[model samples]
Target: MLAHVTVTGRVQGVGFRYSAQQQAAQHNLTGWVQNKADGSVELKVEGPEQKVDRFLEEMKAGFTQFIKVKQIDVDRFNKDEGYKQFSIK
Candidate 1:
């Protein structure tokens, strides 16, 4: 499955992308995380459903101190981007 996640709050310049990369690697997920122009963090992840869910949970729970995660918008990704590994983009 593929998901596009937009995380809002104090998510930039707080190691959120790096933490997300680590979590994605741990879950064997392939995708990319990037800071948006609007001060949000955007993530595109593709992997097993359970792994993807776990990765998201880990990111939210582990970075609570640095990130508030005010809002999270998750959507289905239809394109076949074929990401090989998780990355900070």
Candidate 2:
């Protein structure tokens, strides 16, 4: 499973990408996270259904002190990008 996620709020320059990368690693997920020009954080993660869901849950729950997750828009699909590891892009 793959999830294309957009996180909005106090996300930019607040260690969101790195935090997300760590979380993804914890979930054994593979993909990438990047900061968008629109002040949002965009992430693509691929893994098992349960792990992906857990990763999303952690995202919504605010994994770090600096990250205040106000909203999350996720589009889930059955596509694989063959990512070898989670990273910050």
Candidate 3:
């Protein structure tokens, strides 16, 4: 399974991407995370359903002090992006 996630509000320049990468690695997920031009963080993750859900939960709850996720956009992704490991992009 693949999921595209967009996180908004105070998400950049606060180690969110790095923390997300670590969480993804812990979940054994493969994908990428990047900062958007609109001051948001975008993530593309591919893995088992349970792992992906766990990753998302971690992102939501783990960085509560630095990140205020005012909006989250999640969608089913359908593409063979050939990601080997989670990374900050």
Candidate 4:
């Protein structure tokens, strides 16, 4: 399964991408996480349903500068999301 998550708030420049990469790697997820020009973090992760869900949780509640996570837009997608090994872009 695949999921695309857009996390908004003070998520950029606070090791969010690296943190996400670590979490994704732990789950053996393949995808990418990027910093949007608007300051949100965009992530596309493909893996087991449970692990992906956990990734989403970590994105929202994990140690991200200890700032409030304002919004998270999650989209379930088919298998062709196009990615390999979590990355930051």
Candidate 5:
């Protein structure tokens, strides 16, 4: 499955992307996370269904702490499904 998470907030820096990479790696997920020009971080994670759930949980885990997740738009497993490993794109 593929899960695309677009998080908005003060998520550009403060180790958000790195932490996301860590979380994704921990779940053995794949895809990427990148700092958007609009001061948000967009992440794409692909893995097993259970792992994807955990991935989302892990993603929201740091919200309002390391970063404020004002908004989240998730597109769940609608398309691609072949990501080797997570990355910062």
Candidate 6:
């Protein structure tokens, strides 16, 4: 499974990207996280269905203490880009 996630509200310059990378690694997910110019964080994650769901759940539940996730928009699909590892861009 693959998911594109857009997170908003106090997401930039607060170690969100790095935290996300670490979490993704913990879930054994592959993709990347980046800070958008509009102050939102964008990420793509691909892996098993259960792991992806758990990752998203953790994200929505404030996986990192520094991040305050006010909103999350996710688009799920099956297209595989074959990401080898999680990264912060």
- TM-score, each model? 0.88, 0.96, 0.89, 0.88, 0.87, 0.95
User: lDDT (CA) for every model shown?
Assistant: 0.84, 0.93, 0.85, 0.83, 0.80, 0.91
Least well predicted 10-residue stretch by lDDT in candidate 6: 58-67
**lDDT digits (tens) for residues 1-89 of candidate 6:** 99999999888878888888889999999999999989999999999989999999989876778879999999999877899999988
Clashing pairs in 4: none
lDDT for model 5? 0.80
For 37-69, candidate 5 gives per-residue lDDT tens digits of 888888888888888888787667673376766
Which candidate gets the maximum lDDT versus the true structure? 2
Model 3 ranges with Cα > 4 A deviation? 62-64, 78-80
lDDT per residue (tens digit) for residues 1-89 in model 2: 99999999999988888889999988899999999999999999999999999999999988888889999999999988899999888
Q: Where does candidate 5 stray beyond 4 Å?
A: none
Candidate 1 per-residue lDDT, tens place, 4-57, comes to 999988888788898888878888899999999999999999998888887777
Question: Which sequence of candidate numbers ranks them by TM-score, best first?
Answer: 2, 6, 3, 1, 4, 5
RMSD (Cα, Å) for all candidates, in order, is: 1.7, 0.7, 1.6, 1.6, 1.8, 0.8
Q: Relative to the unseen true structure, what is the C-alpha lDDT of residue 18 in candidate 3, on a scale of 0 to 100?
A: 89
Best of the two (2, 6) by lDDT: 2
Top candidate by TM-score: 2
Better lDDT candidate (2, 5): 2
Q: Write the per-residue lDDT of candidate 3 for residues 55-81, one digit (tens) a residue.
A: 888777746577667777899765547
TM-score computed on alpha carbons, candidate 5: 0.87
Residue pairs clashing in model 3 are: none
Candidate 5 vs candidate 6: the lDDT winner is: 6
